[model samples]
Target: MKKNIYYFDNSATTWPKPECVLNNLKYFLNEIGGSPGRSGHRMSIAASRLIEETRETVGKFFNYDDTSRIIFTKNITESLNICIFSLLKAGDHVITTNSEHNSVMRPLRFLEKKGLKITIVKCNRFGELDIHDIKNSIVKNTKMVILTHASNVIGTILPIEEIANLTFKKNIPFVIDCAQTAGSVPIGINLGKYKNCIIAFTGHKAMLGPTGTGGLCIGKDVSLKPLVFGGTGSKSDEDTQPNFLPDSLESGTMNVLGLAALKASVNYLLKMGVDKIREHEKNLITRFIEEASKIKRIELYGTKEAEKQASLISFNLKNLSPSAAGLILDKKYSIMCRIGLHCNPNAHKVIGTFPNGTIRFSFSYFNNLKQIDYAIEKIKEISRIE
Candidate 1:
């Protein structure tokens, strides 16, 4: 409705968190401004309680059997590092997809140079990875399999359950980077079913929380060595990190404020129901894709249909570069989107738009059909330009 500003970049980071989120952050800053699990005071205890509540809410979201398995990290990137660098050793083989963000790919590549073997399965131009491809990639020495839950640029949702089943049978520790799909899509992963799994989630994206809020859900089979060893309020006497679910992984002072905000966001989502949120986002996708399809010169990426795609879309103009499209959207159309590689060069490569990449328009429950309408109108104009 505003003159020149519509935020359509929820896939990268969601905007306008719920009122509860803001209130919780404000409360944390005002009242519970203490280092959680560190200081032995009422303020610290309150902070710790907020953090635990967030973990419990997130654990239920993923159907985790134990809330304690949820370990806080700065973001999914940090969670990936904790899972990757902690679990994999010198001669281990790891399976992944081409549709991964550099967060996962970068660490894996670094380990690859350190003599860890890596097998990269290529998704099709639409960013669809095959379960058979993953099954074939499993080697005897394979220790872990890491892949992104959804393609950040293209919004292609992977069949984690199918792949998870295969890996579960093979007894491989599966680490999933749920940067785009967590809290946005249905994650009915029964942690009991998968013997080995670690799902890394960020609160800044579809979770609709503030930045610097994220964590990793350590599954049954993945016994990760601690990434950073430090003092936990629970085990202050021990020189080493505590041999527990969260206290082992979490080090230093925790992000109490961010966690408090995330707790409110997660509580709001749970109350609203994930199914309803998915429905809202899916509706936006359907309308947006239909309108974009009618526009000439609009080169859509990922799965062709809206139903096949997640709540995001990536595309480019016939004669415009991604950055140019982004600029036009910002200055003229008032739409905010991500351009260029979208932090996943391999995802861009999979879509045959490597190097330059495409403009990514991802949405969440906050976005409405009317906003999608405005976006469609502006996109039609931009796509037609020479």
Candidate 2:
């Protein structure tokens, strides 16, 4: 008998998107196909309407009143790059956390070479940050404070709401890297009130959208220079780019097909409810951790408190390299997971897994208790081997 395959690597990208997303993707390609805002034709108008509707849906989902402030990009990485490059200039000091993914680290590193000052606040071994460290690091010249809503490796949820309030009080811009938490965790942002906060999100993960779909919700007080330049379908009569919310940052052709799928996925998530999905995944993680704790030689990371973390867990078996165990899980047990640094070397360092990272099992709403039990049993078996 062939063994069934179990997927546990949701932090990389969500698997098995909702049927509505797939159906709409097909429908857009088949029926409504046109470049949005380019022409007055019926097909073009329909496509444009779909894009606007998606923008509004995303805005509503994030509690942002102005849908025009939402700007789409290929992924969260691009969104972060646009924000980083556009907001910070030479000699500007920026604050970030040590647990940030390379999407934020790499850009900040590049900017450091360009005469930008960066302060990387340290997080504890459990991936929890001290709010005081962030506060003390803020100097008069601090241009912005960028942080991840949750650590991708260990899955520790940060106190973004408090940090946002801190930045707002300090009169600094707060940018949140919500690549891992968006659609999975509630981002308490009242866009109408908080004009200094920005939320960057990717659609392929918890949003259950296509890979190429992601965007950023710009606050009212924030403005970013265009990372790319081209035709925005509007203001074609003039040579300069349009001075507007989305069009200023968004140029060239939009990802109509991907956005269509994203719109459908967002609608499904709205109907299903994010809190319900979060609770289900939390149960899976809690169950996994409780069972895995009983196994000898299993060293887990993070706060170990399910409510304090997201749906992911990272740990190692005794005398087992994560890479080797990952291979065993894939080839022998047919369990898929992520191992190694997960693109956040700083997070690994904080957890004392610098060179060799830990095995990561990230759960999703679709995962069941049976799958978690099986994975825990297999991990116990693996730990007993040596």
**C-alpha TM-scores of all predictions:** 0.96, 0.98
**RMSD (CA, Å), each prediction:** 1.6, 1.5
Worst 10 residues of 1 by lDDT: 1-10
True-vs-predicted CA distance for residue 227, candidate 2, Å: 0.7
lDDT of 2 by residue, 293-374 (tens): 9998999999999998888999998768999999999999999999999999999998999989999999877789999999
* lDDT of candidate 2 at residue 186, scale 0 to 100: 78
* Candidate 1 lDDT for residue 256: 82
lDDT per residue, candidate 1, 1-386, as tens digits? 24446899898899867999989988999998888877779988888888888888888777885887888888989999988999887899999998889999898899889999999998998888888999988889999888988888888888898888888888888888888888888776778778587788998988899899898888878788788887777767668668987788877888888888888898888888888998998899989888898888888887866666678998888878999989988987778988899888888777789899888899988889999999999888887787
What candidate 1 gets wrong by more than 4 Å, as runs, is 1-4
By TM-score, the best candidate is: 2
- Model 2 regions more than 4 Å off: 1-3
